[model samples]
Target: MNEKVVVIYSGGMDSFTVLNRALKDGKQVYALSFDYGQRHVKELACAAKVCEELNVPHKVVDISAINQLLAGSSLTDDIEIPEGHYEEESMKSTVVPNRNMILLSLAVGYAVSVEASQVYYGAHSGDHAIYPDCRPEFVLKMNDVCKIANYDAVEIFSPYLEVSKTAILTDGLAMGLDYSNTWTCYNGREHACGKCGACVERLEAFRDNNTTDPLTYE
Candidate 1:
């Protein structure tokens, strides 16, 4: 039997790439999405659609109330999401405190319930500078914690940890993944706000790869 892996899928370019990679690796995939009351709940819809197309079982765990308590971050609150490259200092406002930790904790539990051996999420080098939870150290420590917390030994796998967004896009492209089905804008609109940090990074990635982003932007 192929090992089962649960993907913390957000229906963004990076997470969608992770999902496709797992499928290509012959793993039984279960997609896990969170409704954390983020401004970009639009990604959840895209996530479901992608899962449907892939014929993967998908579940959306509601932790939307976290937005009520963790209210300062731009993603979960009223603060304006900054526009610019992801390397900009202002983009730090977009970091939700302990977001990956919280999500991974929930994902680990789900993995255990499903008797899965691994949980995959997309936290690439691009996110390390601004988001503490996305750094390699955090992933290593979290994997250690998972080992101690679970009897069945679930592993946290981030294949893109040191990879660039452009490299991820290249991989997805090779797999024939449809980038149009993914959503990356933070604005939660019908069209992507091309100015937001997420959009900017995504656009740059495609441009660097000499390809066009399929999603229309405003």
Candidate 2:
């Protein structure tokens, strides 16, 4: 039997690559997506669609009740989503409080229940500047906690932890992955607001890869 693993899929480009990578490694992937009252439901919708096409077991966990607790960030609150380069200081407003920790903790619990020994999330080098939870130090500490949190000792796997968005896109492209299924915009509007940090970074990644983004942007 293939090794069982849990993937924290957000329907974004990074997580999309992580999910497919896990499957390519011959793991039985159980994908978990959090509906934490983010600014938009577009990513969640994209996640569901991709999972369905891949025939992967996917679950969308609703943790929206804690939206108020995780407020202050533009992702879950009233703050304006910043427009600029991804690494700009202004993008800091997009950080949801303790988001990765909360999501990883819940993912660990799901891993325990499913007898999966590993959990993967798509926190890449691009997020290290603005999102503290996505930093290498945070992931290292989270891995330690994940190992001892339960009797099974699940391992936290972040394959793209030290890699850039371009590298991730390159990997996905090598695998013949269609990025159209992914969503990276922070806004819920009909089209992606290309000015937002997320959109800017995504476009940069595609540019770096010498390719075009499949999603339409405003």
Candidate 3:
């Protein structure tokens, strides 16, 4: 049997790229998404669509139990979503506090269930200051931690950890990813709140890459 690779896919540009990379490398891809009381389910829906399009196995883990542990975040709360480009300061509240850790650990468990040794996440350097979990060092440490915790030789993969969001966008484009199918809003609003940190960052990256965005932005 070919090696199986699982991804912490959120149906975003970075996660989309990670999925492509795993598939292109001849691994059977399994995507793990969460319905973790997020402000919106659009991203998880998009994640399902992407997995179907790729003919990969998709798992929608109900992490609402864990999500309840989240507090003071626009993503999981009733707080207003902040709109702005990702800078050093404004992106702070966007942190879900160990969210990536929780998601990745869950993904690792899923991978082990299917005898997969590799797990992938789409965290990038662009998220370092804002999401501590996305930093390269954090990923490295998590890899080590998972190795010891699982004792099953599971290795975590993060292809974009040292790269920029623009690079992820570029890679997704090269892989023929239909970004129109992805959602990045902090709010589960009617339209892409073009002001949220994610939307703004995505818009800027696509623009910087001179790539046309497929998402509807107002």
Q: What is residue 22's positional error in candidate 3, in angstroms? A: 0.9
Give the per-residue lDDT digits (tens) of candidate 2, residues 45-70: 99999999999999999999998676
Q: What is the TM-score of each predicted model, taking all chains together?
A: 0.98, 0.98, 0.95
Query: Model 2: which residue pairs collide?
Result: none
User: RMSD in Å for candidate 3, one decimal?
Assistant: 1.3
lDDT per model, in order?
0.93, 0.93, 0.83
lDDT of 1 by residue, 47-105 (tens): 99989988999999899877766768999888998999888999989989889999999
Full ranking by lDDT:
1, 2, 3
lDDT of 2 at 208: 98
Candidate 3 residue-wise lDDT, 1-218, digit = tens: 77888888887767878888888788888888888888867888888988888789898988787756788777787777776766747668777878888888888888889989999888887888688788888899999998888759788888888989898888878877777888887777778878888888888899998977887767
Candidate 2 stretches with Cα past 4 Å from truth are none
Runs in model 1 with CA error above 4 Å? none
Reference-based TM-score, model 1: 0.98
- Which window of ten consecutive residues has the lowest lDDT sum in model 1? 64-73
